[model samples]
Each structure stands twice: as structure tokens, then as C-alpha cells.
Target: ERLALQALDRADRLGVAGYVLGIARELTGDFAGSMRCYEAALKLLPNHGAVAGDLGRLAFRMDMPEIAAKFFMHYLQARPGDLEGVNNLACALRDLNRCEDAIEVLRPAINEHPAQPLLWNTLGTIMCSLGDGVTAVTFFDETLRLAPEFGKAYHNRAYAKIDLGDVEGALTDCELAISVAESAEDLATMKFGRATILLALGRVAEGWKEYEGRFSADLLEAPRFTIEGERWSPGMDLASKSLMICAEQGLGDEVMFANMLPDVIEALGPQGKLSIAVERRLVPLFQRSFPQITVTPHRTVSYEGRVYRGAPEIEDWSAIDLWTPMGTLLETFRPTVASFPNRLNFLVADPARVEHWRRELENAPTGPKVGLLWKSLKLNGERARQFSPFMLWRPVFETPGVTFVNLQYGDCSEEIALAREEFGVDIWQPPGIDLKQDLDDVAALCCAMDLIVGFSNATTNLGGACGAPIWMLTGASSWTRLGAQTYPWYPQTRCFITSDYNDWDPTMQKVGVALKARFPMA
Candidate 1:
């Protein structure tokens, strides 16, 4: 502690007060403290180009991209020839969701600093984020030309190649990235990327093994559970010991993995206690679904040995096994489509709410009830592949005898208005339906619809769970492995896939044809 204070004093004397403070606060996980320190430093010496650039970086980390853009622009103005500052500004603009502005900002910088590897890498990342993989690949290639050993450039370029349907190119880059990775985390990232690409390419056997790399950290940290005299298998003599199955991921993962519980229990037989750790939101659902097993929320779980002080504690169990609901598990046990579960009677809204919806539908006599899902809850690398609100079901709206109902959340007002003006149809939006308050509202709404059509998202899941006939649209990469017409999880769902990357027109046309065939008037 004394040595740390001496270093802080030295930093203050060296005119690195803000930088030192930011580092200190960040180490303690106080992001707000780091932001304030960085902001103060910038205010003190506004013309310090390096400090301004650092401030921009800190602002971006705080999720204040607009503020970060200002700082970056100031940094660029101070040091007009600074390629790094220019690239940082472009990234800030991109984070602010001004992709065109970001692209325009980088053009002059690229012209001036043509051979700067970092600048080219930044440009590639921005273009990739904006859904222009073709241009991104070009920029990544330029980056590789200047810095051949840059593993990150290779990894990102592989992603762009995958987006553009260049699978072989992506695989080659992945292999190169894996070879250069120094840390376990870096190795895991490259392995995961390669595994994802392999999964996309329908090479499941190799992909599944690489995918197991995800458990490294957890396996290292947690104590392994072993029974004294029992051997674990599908069916073994396990009359005395308990088997713990811990949930290792998200809510959707929990739902997906819950399907595997019956098999786990059947394997363990009636004597062994199958204990599971799951998220709080899933407690009721899991309890209702699997009454036989012992389900504990993660918050309630405890640890022992070198007990980390202030950490929540729970009982130390005899035998623990971690399970994630990855696609590989489904592929292994239920390889055939026939093994898929059909018990999809979701608990929708009350009868009164259904009656209210029925009355509203009855008021509109001429058109078939159509459900619209313009958004999904999950946001990450895969989100770009999910359908945007502006893109889906345009052809379906163009078809006659179809009435579109809005089931989307988050920034959908603009899309709703545009849809109203373009289609000249009053898009039905229900009032006061909070997702948290009414978890099954979408399923309830699907209960009233003649046919449900949307992107492969939560709404699609809801429709499928409600046993509604659904026309689900997916990206080419996703549909290649999952299949073109059917999903094992959702029995009522039929998939329509894009033939090319970022091209939804053909898929939309297929959906239109299916709609017409299924509903003659539509």
C-alpha cells in the first residue's frame, strides 16, 4: 500500500495526474471515477494532443461516444498529422452510430497516412461494424501488408471473409491467428472463432471439440466433484451420491439446456438428486417444468476452501458437473429430427386478455391477422445477421389480405411510422405490454394470429412455443447448419434462408410465396 502511494506521488510530480488517477480508478472497477479524472486532465491541458486522445478513449469506454468524438476531434486538430488521432475519432463517430460520418472522416486520414497499419485496421473494423464486409476485407488486407504478424487483424479479417461467404479464406486466417496467440484467452478466442466458422461450414465434429475450450477458466477455478466409489454414465449404480448440474450461461441457454434435464435425470435414475444452478428469472419456469429436480439460483450458491471474503456462500456439494446448452449437445443426443420435443403449450395471457384481442381482431374484418417481430433481445456479433426492423416482411405487407401487428420493442417508433406511411395500413400495437410484466404476451398475441412471420429471434421462439404456424427467416450462414425448412426445437417453425450474405430479397420472396400458398387470400 505504501509503495502504491509512492507511485501515485511520482505520477503526480511527472504531470501524469489524470492518467495515473484513471489507471488507479480503472483497477478498482470504478469507471465513473476514471472518466472524471480523464475529463479533468483534458480540461487542464486542452491542447495536449496525447492527453486529448486518451480522454477520447476513456469517454468511449464510459459509453459516451459523442463526448469521445469531441475529444478525438480536438486531438486531431492539435496534431493535424496524427493518424492514430484520426482513427480514434472515426471509431468514436462509429460508436455514436454515425457510420457514414465515420467512413467519410477516415477517407482523408487514409489518403494522408496511406501506409499506417493501425489506421487501416481501424477503418476495417468500422466498415465491418457498418455491415460492409467487402470493403472491410480490403482494409484488413492493407493492414496485413504493413504488419504481417498482427493476429487481431487476421482474426477480424477472417470474420469479414466469413461474412462474405469466403469460408476457406476465413479458415486459413483462423489457423494463422491460433499459431500466433500468446495467452489462454487469446488462444480461446481464436479457437472459438475457428469453431464458429467450422460450425457454419457444417464441420460439427472438429468444431465441438474446439468449442469445449470455453470451459477452461471455469474448470480451472472450480473444484472438481468426485464420488467415492461411483462411476458416472447414462445409467450406472448411483444409489448413494448426488449429481449437481450447474447452469453456465444466459437465460436462453438455460431454456435450451432445460430440455436435456430429463435425459440427465433418467441417466442418474430415481435415487440421485439432480441439483441445478440457474438464473433467477428461470426459477419459476424450471420449477414448473422439472418438479423432480432441485433447482437453485446462482445468487444462492456458496463456495468454500480459500473462501473469498464478502462473496456469497452456499453448501459444498459432493459431485458437480457444468453444462452449457450449446448446439452440439442438441446435435449429439437428438441427431434425428424425430427426437425433438413437442410439449410446447406455453402459458400465454389470461382468457380476458385473449377475449380483448379477439374483439380487436373482430373489429377489423377484411384482412388476415399477421404478427410482426422487428427486434431481438440478444445483441452481439450475431445481431448483425438478425433482421433489422426496416428490412423484414416488406413483401408480406405488399401482399393482399394481410394485417400487420407490431410486436417489436426498443427504438421501433420510427420504423412503425415509416411502415404506416409506406403500407398505408394501420399497424396494430398493443398498449401497456411490458415484457417483464407480461412474459408471455407475444405467445398470447400469436394465439390470435392466422399465421406468424418474422426473423429468427425471440418472437419466432414465442410463436413456435405457442404452436403457431411460423415462417421464420434466417441468415445463410445460420441456416446452412440449422437447416432450410425445419428446426428441432420449434416443431411448428419453417425457415426461409438468404441465399447470399446481407441479401434478404430472395428470402423475402420465398416468404411471400409461402404466405400466398398457406393463406390463399394473402
Candidate 2:
């Protein structure tokens, strides 16, 4: 790369040299530098297809889909015969939620280059995005048939199979994906994908260990922990040791992984001590729940399009005997289904708030006080498909003898209003609670409800952790369920696993039936 840059001293192939330098910068994780070099290359040679394609990919990775799509379109215009250009353009279109446009873009390429595995793979991905898993599976099958060594197709097939209610098939595909993967980057990501499948298949022992691949440097994503200490591992001496467990992942995942905290505490013994860094909002809750363990809020900051999590509160890293990402503890403690304890109220909410919510529920004239959370606030990409529409929650709202409490945090006034206008049901908003900001009080409010029903989110996870009866409407083969009908992490859990997102109406109907049976009408 340095030689290519020096070649610019001769003023020969200046655009190509700049492009080479861009690639070199990209390889070294200097995306901003890469962007500058690529832009310079494109500015020098307006018709450079390779530079355009690379710029499009980088833009896509940086979450600039509009700019990416523009570049991809330019690249395709310049190099119409390139199967890669067609595939990339289609991918960008799909990211923009222009699936039909993506299909139109891909169809000509697949027709022109019928044997190209990537074209077929792109088609499969687009179909998967459309919630057409059956069709997506077929496309993936064709992609794999054309090129058996193609790793990404196998990984994608696993994802499609998951939605098709084929956990066993997904697991098989995950294994094949790992075996066929060529790059360290691909292998790391494939292993992480396999972990989800293994856990979904109830193979917790292997799943927990493989799950660490998420933090692998080679993987083309960032959820990196900035811990400054000797990382704890399985078989580490915990007795009389001072350990720090820094939380990882999203709020729900942090809460779910926290099932192992009590085990860590007990293993540490009375002489030993523990400290934890959780999400800032969760500091109070974690401190109250685990009085024996010191709790501090974790710091998360995004820099140059990368997320870094750290526990900065402990200035003296040397003071700690060992530190580990909280998720890693699962490998040591929860090896199998039987290894998980029937833990209850592991996250103790504020007693005063709990009593206050209980009194509020008591004042309600009749029927069960059912707390409801339908969808996650962060509905990005495929996640938007995982949740049913508010209109589809009709049967759930139709349930008799139930006063629905709106536990959904984000601006759910639209849903609340719809329930009143369409279903003649008033989903009551609990007073004095800013549902999103007041997560500490949310736990207590969850505790007060007779039953909490929702798709898996931070609040439902909190409700489950606090020992509330949570009927979690989860996806089929959700790894968090650990391949069980019951959520092993929480003591009080009743799962309603939806096999297909396209048809969650029947599942919601079942939930209504179950709800009616649990708390029959007057």
C-alpha cells in the first residue's frame, strides 16, 4: 500500500493508487481515512467502478443507505456486467426497504448470470427480509447447490430455517456455515450465529462457550468491551476473590445474562467480594437486588461508528482479582439446562413503588390488572417483522375481565388510542411514571401486575427477573428460551413462542384463550 502511494510520486495511475490506499486504510479499520481516499480516487476518476463499489460498501456499513444506493447505482451503470455490482445494488435497495426495487435490480442479473451463487444469495436475503422464509430457504438451497463451499448462504439458511420452525435444520446449517467459512471474519460471525442456534436447540454447554465469538476482533461488527484487568475464565478461583462483572449487550440481554449473577455471588463466598457495572438506568435496581455486590453504572460511547463498553467507575483495575464480561459467566455457571437455578425475584424492585402500584391495582373496580407490552422500542431491520401489528393484538385486547395496563415504554399513544376506538378497550397509562425514563419504577410496576404479557423487551425481561408472571410472546427458537418451553433465566415465565411472524394472529389468539383461562371473566 505504501509502494502504491509512492507510485503517485511518478504521477502514474493516481486514481488506482488512491483506491489501493483506501483499501489499505479500510483493512486497518480507518473508515474515515478510507472514505477520504475513496472520495479522492472517485474525484480523480469519475468512472472508476471499483472505487464506486467500495465506496458504496463502506457507506452501507456506515449506515448511509441513501448515499450507498446512489454509489451502487453509479457503479452498476459503469459496470453493468459485474454480478457483484448487481448483488451490491440489490443489497443496498433491500436495506432501504425497497424490496421490490431490489428484486427488479437482481432479476436481470440472475437472468444474465444464472450460475452466480451471490446473485442467488442476494435474492434469498431479499426474500428473507420480506418474511418469505419458505421462498428464502429455496433460494438459499439453490445458492448452496451452486457453490457448496459458500459459507454465508449456509448461515442465512439457518436464519430462514429458524423462522420456518426448523431449529434442527438451523443447527445443521450453522455447523456447515462454520466448517465452510474461509475468512477469520466470517468464521467468528458464523460461530456467534451458531451459538444462537445451539442454545435454541437446548445445547447450552456448547452455546455459552461459542457465544464469546461475538466479541472476536475479526468479526465485522462492534460490541467491544474495554475492560482493564485479567479476564476471568471457567475454573477460575472465585473463593475469596474480588471480581468485577461488566454487563454486555442490550438491556434485555444484560438482564437475561444476569441469571448467573447469584451463582457468581455464592461461589465467591462470604469472604470474597463482587462489583458490577450495569446500564446507567439499572444501577439502582442492581444495587438493591444484589446488596452483597457493589453496583456501578457502565459507560458506553460510540466513536467513529464503533461501540465501546467500559466500567470506568473502578479506577483501580489492579484492585480487582479478576474481571469478566457478565455474559461469560454463563459458560462457567450455566453449562446445561439443569445447571440453571429456579431463581425468583433476583432483581428486587423498589418496595415502596411496588406497594403503591399494588394499591392502584386494588382501586380498579374489577377484572385482572394485566400489564401489556407489545413491541420493542428499537424496531430496526428484521426486528420490525418479529412483532405483530397493533391491530393484530385484537384478540389479546378482546379478552374479557381484564383491565389492560400500557407497559409499552415508547410513544404508544397511537396504540392506546386505537385500543379505545377500535376494541372499546381503554389501556390505562399508570400515573406518575415516565415509562421509558423511569425503568427503576417500571420494575416495581411490573411486580404489581397480576400478569405481564409482552414480546421480549427490556421491560418484560425486568418483569421476568422480578418474579412477575410474564407470558413472553417470543420468536420460535429464540436462544434466550434455551430450547425450553419455559424461560430458564426467570422463575416465573410462560412462553408463547410464535412460529412465524407473518402469522402471529393465531398465536395472539392462543394468548387470549390462555389469558381467558388463567383469569376467567365474570
Candidate 3:
């Protein structure tokens, strides 16, 4: 790549040379340099700059979706109604967190070019991202109708079907995708998709086996598990060796996976040592809960002499004999539904903190204190399904002898005020607590509450882990497994789901009635 860049530099053909240099730089992973070279090439070629498409692709790679969208627009202007260009622009918009805009960008193109499978596929992808999986399935079906041989469409359609409670359809799509996959990466993706659907359907043994495909060729850009040691598998006896369970994904996932810590500890016995890698913010909470195991933050310092934010950085890598991702624990510990070691008090909150919150709640009106969360921090497509407007929770708010407390994280002061004005109710925001940062306090707060009612987010997870009485108002589809009214992981966290996608009216009324019965005034 460096030799190619040097050769392109020496060619000195001005416009074309600069464009070739940009491509060479991008190949060598120097995205900033590539952008600069592309900009120089664009200046040299002006109105006839053929590098617009390349620039758009480069910007999209760099996560500058707005800039990518602008470049795609320019490229589309030169060649209007280009199917690939339209799809690229919509994808850029989707990455920018503008799903509606992405849909709008492709909808006109789809009508104009009715036979284009790529347009329908792109629209389906965007709708899936926005959590409208039912609608996304229709779009994906249209794509398949146009291009039956498209393996990517099959892979995407599988996800849409999973969200729509059609596991059989999803499995069929996965089989179709696997059969038509042209590359090793595509094959791995189909396998992983099949694994997720299998897990959701309670086929744990096959799902766990298929899940090994997550680390397949050319799929993960970085090491899936950062711990540089032998990965612990089933049959590897941990009773006499040191084992590390490295955290994967988000905070909620970490907490959910930690439910199996007791099982791991029991498996290891008295002689073995157990260590865990979790998010930095969760260190205190995990430490307080599990005093037997060593807890460390999972952050990494990259090879480029720059710290990679949110990547797990193993502090002491020498002592651990075997290491595995926390998610992988489910394969061995919970291979069957009956094997799930359900617990009431797996996570212990600080008693001091619990008392502190208890005293604060004492001054409030004497009633059933409830915590509520309406929105997630990041409003991705699946999360959009979990949302319930403040107005929709009116029945619960109007219930007498109930003191509502705000547990929704992020800047929701405006929402609180709006609820007060519109519903003639006030949700008391607790003083001196950052809901996002303070998991320990959040756990204590959950303990302090009489009940916690919210969507499927971090707060609900925290409460569920703490054994607090929590009623989760969920959407039709959830990775947390919502086929049952009660989750196997957390016995206290009862789930009340909407009958159809985004229809909260019936669910809300059920919750209101439940609340009245649970907290009837004498």
C-alpha cells in the first residue's frame, strides 16, 4: 500500500494521480489522508471530479455520515436515478440517525425504478433499524421478489422475521442465505443470525454451537475477545485454575450475564480464583455485589498509541490461565431452560445507600412509590419499539395513592414538566443522583422504591438484578426473550407487552388496573 502511494505520488498526473493516491491511502487505513487527497483531486477536476462516489464511501467509512450524504447527493446529481447511488445516500442518512430522511431518500427512487431490488433492500434495512420490523419484512419480501439470488436480502429478512415472532420464517431465511452466500463472511453472518434465532426459540445446544461463527473469517475487524489466553470451553475444568470472564457489549448485558457468576463460582470451587472484566462505571457495583471475585475495567490502549474508548483494556493479563467472554457462559451454564439457576437476590445493593434513599422517600406522600423510564439513551430501531409516550402512561399517573418517581436517564427535565402540565401529575426527580453514571445508587434507589415500572432499558435491568419489584412494559420483540410474561433471569421483573407493535393502549390499561389492585387505599 505504501509502495503504491509512493508510485502514485511520483506519477504527478494531477487530478487522476490525486484520486489514485486517495485510494492508496484508504487501503493503508489512513482515512484522514485519503479525505485530504480526495479533496485535492476534487479541486483539480472541479465539475468533472469523478472522485465524488469514492469520497462518499470514504466519509461513510470514517463515520462522517452527513459529509457522506452530501458527497452521495453530488454523485447522484451527475447521474440521477442511479440505483447504487440512491442506496448509498439512504445508508449514509441511516448512519446519521435520520431514519425518516433515509426512507424519504429511497421511496421516490423505488417508485421511479420499480424493478430495482437494491432500493427495496436499502429501505428494508432502514425500517429494520427504526424497529418497524413488520414493515421491514414487506420491503425485504419485495427485494427478494425482484432478486431471488441476493443473499444479503435473505440475511436481512431473517432479522426482520426474528423481530416479528416468526422464528420458523427466520430459520428458513437463514438457510436460504447460507445456501446462496458467495463469501466466507456472508456464510458466517447467516450462521450467527441463525444462532440468535435459535437462542430466542430455546434451542440452546444448537444455538451455542452455531454461535462460534461470530469469530469467523473477515467478519470481526478486531479481536472479539481481547484477553490473550486460551478461551475457556465446556469440559475445561476451572476447579483448579484461574479463570477470567471478560465483559462484552453494554452495561445492561454485563449485569444480565453476571447472573451466572454464582454458577461459575460453584464450578470453580474453593481452590480456583475468578476475575471479571466489566465497564469502568460498573466496577463499584460489581465489587460491592461479588466480594469473592476480582473486578476490573475493560478498557484498551490501541496499537496506534491512542486509547480506544470503550474497548476492554486488560490491566494484568499474566495471572489468568483461561479467559472467556461473559456471554459465552450461557452456553455451558444454561444449556437448557431447566438449567437456569433463577435467583431472587443475586445482586446486593449497598445498605448505606439504600437507607439514604429510604430516608429521602420518607418525606414524600404515603403511597406506593414507583420509578418510571420512558426512553433509552440511544433511539435505535429496536429501542424505538420500547418507547411509550408520557401521555400513554396517564392511567398509571392518575392512580391515587401512588407517588411517581423519575428513573428515566438522560435529560428528561422537559418531559417531567410536560407530564405535570398535561396529566395533572408530578414525577419527582430525586436529588443528587446521576442515573446513568451511578449504578450502585440506582440499585439502592430501586431497593428504596415500592415498585419500578418502565421499558426495557438499564434502569429496569438494574432493578431486576437488585430483586426489586419491577413491571416492564415491553414491545412485541425483545432479545431479552419476551415469550413468557415472566423472565427466567429475573423472577421479580414481570413483563407486560403490547399486543401489536407500538400499540400501548391495551397494555397501559392493564398496568393501570394492576396498579389499582396492588395499591388499593384502605
Candidate 4:
């Protein structure tokens, strides 16, 4: 890369050297430098269509989809017949949440390049993202017809089948994907995908075993602690050995997986001391909830023996023998549905914060205070499909003798205004609460509420984790097993799922009826 840059600096004949230097820089992961070089090349040769594509891909990788779309459009203008440019342009539009634009870009590409399996596969993926699983299956079938041995197409097809509620078909595609996988990462991804399908189908034993492929997918965030011994596995004697369970994934996942910690402690017996490392925001809650186990933020620790107990800052290796990811707890602790702790209110809110919210809520009209959360922070088509638009919750907001409080994070001031102006329903937004950062106070607020209702998000998980009565409105395909009305992780929570893709009317109607049962109008 350095040599290419030097050569480009020495002589840029017709901007070709600059283009070569940009490619070299991009290959070396110097995205910013590559973009600069690509821009310089494009400035010299305005008609350099390939350079525009390079800049588009670079911008896409850097999460600047708007910039990527501009470059992709420029490239498409120069070479209108370029199928690859069309596919890339579709990707940029898809990333920008313009699925319709993406579809329009690809429809012509499909007609022009009928033999291109990748184009069909890309269309399938985008359709899956858009929650059009049935349509996505058709695209995947087209890809498979063109290239029967394409591993990624099979994998993509499996995801769509899963979303379409065809677990058996998904499993078959997963097997085909695994069979055609060329690389270890591809094989691991197929296995992990199978795990998700299996787990979603409530096949816990095999699902957890296949979930170990997550590490092979190069997706495991480094564990908080360096293990002195082997990773914990089935039939491992935890009674005599202290275990450290490191939290992985999002805040919601950590909260969900920690449900197995109590079982781990009981299995460890009196001789064992289990330590849990979680995100900093959850440390206080975890410490208060599980006093028997040591809870700390993720860190590097040095220790000698079992005696170094000055608030779990450091631990002794002699006492701590085994370490495992929090998700791994499912393997042994929760082998069956019957074995679930089934305990709600595992998480306890700060009494002072709870009291503060309660006092403030008392100032409002006398009614059942309901906490409302609508959208997730994750900006993706899948998440968007799961959300019941603020407008969809209109009928519930109109319920008599029920006061709604805003627990929905992010800037929804306009939506709140619309509710107040159009529907004449006032959803109260509490002052001085940063719904994103101040999670402890959020938990306290949830605890104080008569009930919390929302789509699946971190706030809903946090509220459910705090043992609040949460009515979680979920999409058709949730990562967690939604076979039963209630999730295994949260005992007090009731899940209300949409009957079809993006349909929340039935769920909202059910919530309305349930609300009437709980808080009858005088």
C-alpha cells in the first residue's frame, strides 16, 4: 500500500496510478485514505466510472449510505448496463431504509441479468429484511435455480424460511448451506443459523450445543476475563470450582441470560463462589439482586488464592477454576422448561428512585399509570417491522381510566404531539430522565408503573427483568422462543405477538381488553 501510494505520488498518468493506490489502500483497511485517493482519481478523470463504484463501496462500509447512494448513482449514470453497479446501488438504497428504491433498482437488474445468482440472492436478503418472507423465498428459489451449489443463497433462503415460520424447511436449507460451505467461517455461520432456528423452535438441548459455533463465526466479543483453565462444558463439576460467567451481546441479552445465574449458584453449592461480569449499567442492579454472587463490571483481574475478597475488584485463580459465557448457562442450568427458575422480580429497583417516580406520578389524574415504549434504537427493516407505530397505539391511548407515560426512548416529540393534538390523549413524558443513559431510573420508573406495554426493545427487557408486568408486542419471528404466551426468561411478562407481518391491530385490541380487565373505568 505504501509503495503504491509512493508510486502514485511520483507519477499519476491519466489518474490510473491514483486508482491503483486507492485499491491498495482499501485492501489494507485504510478506508479514509482510500476514499481520498479515489476522490483525487475521480477529480482528475471525471468519467472514471469504476472509481465511483469504489467510493460507493467505501462509503457503504463506513456506514455513510447517503454518500454511497450518490456515488452509486454517479456510477450507474456512467454505465447504465452494469449489473454489478445496480446490485451495489440497491445495497446503498436498502441501507438508507429505502427498500422500495432498492427493489426498483434490482428488478431491472434481474430482467437484464437473469443468470446472475448473486443478484437474486441479494434480492432475497433485502426482501427478508423488509419482512416479506414469502416473496423472499421466491427470489431465493430463483438463485438456487441459477446456482444450485451456492452456499450463501442456501443460507439466505434458510433465514427467509425461518421468518416464514417454516422451521423444517429452514433446517433443510441450513443442512445444504453447511454441506456447500467452503470456509470454516461459512460452516460456523450455518451452524449458528441452525442454532437460532432450533432454539426458536424450542429445541433447547441441540440448539445450545450448536450455538458454540458462534466463536468460530469470529463474532464472540473477547471475554472480560482471561481463563486460566478450560471453558465450562456439560457435566463439569462446579460444586468445588468457582466459575466466572462473562456477559455477552446486548443489554437485553445479558439480562435474559442472567436468568440462569441463580441456577448456577445453586448447582455450585456452598463450596463454590460464582462471579458475574456484566455491563456497568447493570452492575448495581445485579449486585443488589444477587448478593450471594459477586457482580462486577468487565475488567482484567490479578489474584492469588480465595482470600482476596475486597469487593470482587480482584479474585484468586485457585478459587476460580472455570469460566463461561452467560449464554452457555442454558446448556446445563436450563436443560428443560420445567427447570427454569420461573421467578419474576429477580431484579430490584432502588427504593428511593421508585418512590420518586411514584410521588411524581401521583400528581397526575387518578388512574392506572401505564409505561409506553414503542420503537427500538436499532435502525433496521427487521426492527422496524416489529414496532407498532405510535399511531397504531391510538385506540389503547384512548382507554378510559388509564394514564400513559412515555418510556419510549429516542426523539419522538413529534409523535407525542400528534397523539395529544389529533387523539386528545396525553402521554406524559417525565422530566430529567435520559431514557437512554439513566437505566437505573428507568427500571425504577417501570417498577412504579401499574403496567408497562411496548414492542420488544431494551426498555421492555429492562422493565420485564425488573419483574414489572410488561405486555410486550412482538413480531412474527422473534429471536426468543415465543411458542408460549409468556417468555421463559420473564415470569411476570406477557407477550402479545402480531398475527401477520407488520399487523398490530389484534395485539393492540387484546392489550386494550386486558387493560380494561386490570383497570376498570368507574
Top model by lDDT, which number?
2
- lDDT (10s digit) by residue, model 1, range 1-522: 234446556764333566567667655645566666666666766677777787787677555678889988888889985777778888777766677788898898778778888888888887777667788899999998999987878888988887676777888998898888766656767877887677666565566555555545422122232212232333234343466554544444445445556656675576666766665555555565577877766543223211111102235544444332223354444444455567554323345555677677776645788777755655433354446436455776777777777766555777777877886667777666764335445456667777777775545555565467777776655622332245555666777766454566777877777777777875
TM-score of 2: 0.92
Better of 2 and 4 by lDDT: 2
Question: Candidate 4: where are CA atoms >4 Å away?
Answer: 1-78, 182-185, 217-230, 299-319
Per-residue alpha-carbon lDDT of model 2 for 363-418, expressed as tens digits? 66478899999888776445666777789888888788799998999899888888
lDDT per model vs. reference:
0.63, 0.87, 0.78, 0.78
lDDT of 4 by residue, 1-522 (tens): 667667766886548778888898766655677888899899987888999999898887666789999999999899986888898888888877788889998998788778999899888878877767788899999999999999988998987877666777888999999999976647777888888787777777788877776656232222234545567978777886788887876788888787777778888898888888887778888888899888887643322110111224545656678888778778787765566666986688888999999999998777889988888788765456556766777668768978889998899888899889887988888888999888888889899999998877778888888888988787555657534445777877777776555356777888878778778882
Estimated TM-score per prediction? 0.77, 0.92, 0.89, 0.85
- Residue pairs in steric clash, candidate 2? none
Distance from true position, residue 315, model 4, in Å? Answer: 8.6
Candidate 2 CA-lDDT value: 0.87
Tens digit per residue, CA lDDT, model 3, 186-212: 777788878877876777767777776
TM-score of 4: 0.85
Off by over 4 Å in 3: 11-18, 21-50, 58-64, 95-97, 129-132, 182-185, 220-224, 300-316, 482-485
Clashes of each: 2, 0, 8, 0
Q: Which model scores highest in TM-score?
A: 2
Candidate 1 segments exceeding 4 Å error:
1-4, 7-48, 55-74, 182-186, 214-251, 275-283, 294-367, 377-382, 388-392, 479-485
Candidates sorted by TM-score, best first: 2, 3, 4, 1
Estimate the overall C-alpha local distance difference test score of candidate 3: 0.78
**RMSD (CA, Å), each prediction:** 5.9, 2.7, 3.2, 5.5
Residue pairs clashing in model 3 are: 129-381, 130-381, 131-381, 298-312, 298-313, 299-312, 299-313, 300-313
Q: What is the lDDT of residue 392 in candidate 4?
A: 71
